[model samples]
Target: MRRTILSSILVMLAGFAHAQTPECDRLCSRDFMFSLDSGLDVMPLVADGEHANGHMEDGRTPLIWAALDPDDEDAIVFTSTLLFAGGDVFAQDSKRGMTPLHWHLFRVGGPMKEVVAMYLGEGASVISKDNFGYSVLDIVNGVATAELYEVYELPYVNDEVADMIRGWAELEERWKDAFGMHLGRDPTSVRYFEVLAEEGYIPAMYAYASVLEKPKVEGFTPDIEQALYWYEEAASVGEVNSIFHVGSSAYSGTDTIEQNDAMAHEWLSLGARHGDTNSQSLLGLMYANGKGVERDIQKGLMWMIISLRFGEDTPDRVRLIDEMSSALSYQEVKEAEQMAKDCIINFFEHC
Candidate 1:
């Protein structure tokens, strides 16, 4: 009985030793909080709501620390492991509701894209609102970096955030000019578009195309071909406006290209199918007039009704839809209108 008891004691000791091994407590350290360069392996520290290394000074996680230093490899790894172990990526500090994502976006420089991507992929909510009600998208869009544009292109974000990013990319030049002068920089000739385009910014490419196509001074002419080329580049990256512009340019015979309604219809239809209200409205007009597809009043009414449902507060589109509805029989118009209402309800409810 004594020998059996001794064997049991040895087994328990061995298990405890194994459980507390270096690999098991990889991120368990006292000094990890202050030092961003600590090459501490963090995979072993499972995030179970208990501070892994007693590192929470005022309830801040190691992830928050990592997010503050954009280039800290150890910090990144530590945060990644914490997220993997079910750390709340959206957890707020005691002072504010800033999530790890907000910190990484606003603090980190260029390489923060990968870190942001990692958190997003792990189900970090981009819509997590801060104390001031600003979301991660708001924080990211506030930063004027080509790197931020690259982060915005990740497919994990929702359409709303993506649209905001695209709008910022389009207006980056205007923003730079307005703010650049305060920084003692040349405001009018900033190459922000070029830098962002080189970083694979689809919206920047589209904006560059617009600049290229704009009327030039008396000594120079707008480079239509180059504009078309950049538009094509933007379209290749799934930019809806770029697709719309390309189709419109082709139909209008701009840039010395022959007008081709059939090709225009193809691209416009493609954009409409991808949820572009502008493309939908244009395609509806074409169908109504028999300019592209066969004139099917029913199909035209359907597309127009759908576009009106999703379109912005545009008086012209509203007036056009009303006019088009007037041409339909009472029953047809009522049915189309009901369908549009149902679509709106279903979209909001499901989305």
Candidate 2:
């Protein structure tokens, strides 16, 4: 009878495990991007479930899985997708206090260099202490032996790479100090920004573009195509600043991108919806002048008004608002104001 009861308990446990598979599999799957991009609604995962960041009990996320999965190709794309789809890159393991950055740093070579750089661009800390209170700099510094590299599956890399990996913390520190922890100037540092940008770092894309756009007359000719490519790449991940940059650039056709009003309108509208002040402000003016969209004076004022809430008041903006105010009736202005309120209230979901 006891044997039969044990058998029944085992079957029930197995059934419970099978039943729990769908949600976990959908989220923690190595190819989660494939499923997510294929129409899986991300709301359910982020709504009540903590799957993306995982909890203290698991210390696992799609990024951790993808990073460890030796078979997963183009894991960077998947990682970027996770960030875009609302995965928390800064999520610390409740028990270990380690981050995705720590995990990637624990295995530094091959695609890892760029992957970790992308995380750094996304604001992952390089010096945070773990559960054992050891930072990556403390643990991995001067510890690059053959067995260590082999453990991380980096047999192809040479001994010189040890210096490269060990010295990376200092280089990263210099890169950060060069920019005051931001993306501006000091283009000579962080030569890997383009690689990280290609691996889906929005800021790196913007930074790499800045590096290209910097005024230089020797050794490197600024490629506008490359600049536009990074801008568009950054824009793809809904980086508001990148969206504005791309939209503004697209709107003003130069020797680079031929002016496409429809495309400009589309990109700017996306930027505006995503709550970028520059985009909202530009979209307001665009709608007012019908530059890239149909002339809707009230609609223009609506977005311009929204932009004002987040940005500094400027003379040009004030003058434009005054002009639009004179052009609009009281009722029309009130309606636009209400519409702006509704846009905010809806969290831009229906905006």
Candidate 3:
């Protein structure tokens, strides 16, 4: 095993050595793209100073290429790796003068907010514009519609991407309006949210469903049917919170939602992989108790440890930890802990 591991390391080092150039054009090389798409560590290619920010012939950096493909299964992993390796989030392509964030918004999609948030967190400027004078906010706030697309001579946007951008803007507006109304104690806040939810705004669907599930206001009764409907709706769109709610409800068999351990396992697995701590905790319980799936103590304990690391501690959680810890051998506990650490490092994708 040691020999095999050493051989693998040597092979990777050989490839990395072959890929590097003195001038550092590795970021845009075909080999680099292959490495990124294959989930090989491209960090080696960028580890040398300034290579992470290097551009191609078209003046597009690796980050820009990654941003252009939000739909790719490997995009997020590659994008995050590039960012971690110090890819300049503000790097603008030569032709479009669009930053990574701007290029991200210029695509056709159903909101890549996680990727957008990552760029924003790294200080990507939202006000930055393209050569056509369109800001990131302009595209995302509904200002860059089909009419403006024509006016700006952005023929590359086409009808589909323009419609998607318009939809994104509408969703943003609905989210802001609904949030403001709710905070201001407006009586029609729920109705407003319901309208947005019906329009397929995911956050509104979750909010509306939450209100129906448990009415904090006086004079409103619980509507289990509508709550479950919206919860399921939002979950279908990969809304993490709604996925947790639906999974939890399905596991515990709510008034309207039936008890189906299989459905609970499926949904909670999705939620857990999306980094929902509650989902992780519940999935741990499921694995530990063999509730919906086969029992696996180490897998269960790993998730419990992960949940405790990322979430606030509770009495039930502590007790579960103690119980699971007592049941596992020392080696089992150590392995489980290592698994939890790796799971977190991989952004829960491997978990």
Q: Name the best candidate (by lDDT).
A: 3
Better of 1 and 3 by lDDT: 3
Backbone clashes under 3 angstroms, per model? 0, 0, 0
**Predicted structure with the largest TM-score when compared to the true one:** 3
- TM-score of predicted model 1? 0.44
Candidate lDDT (C-alpha), each: 0.50, 0.53, 0.62
Candidate 2 residue pairs that clash: none
lDDT of 2 at 212: 68
TM-score of each: 0.44, 0.49, 0.52
Task: Give the alpha carbon lDDT tens digit for every residue of 189-227 in model 3.
Answer: 888889888876667888999989987666688998888
Ranking by TM-score: 3, 2, 1
- List CA RMSD, all candidates: 21.3, 16.3, 11.6
Better of 2 and 3 by TM-score: 3
**Tens digit of per-residue lDDT, candidate 2, span 120-168:** 5454555566665666555445333434323543223334433544455
Q: Compared with the true structure, what per-residue lDDT tens digits does model 1 show for residues 317-347?
A: 5566666666789898666555443433333
**RMSD, candidate 2, Å:** 16.3
Error of 2 at 289 (Å): 1.1
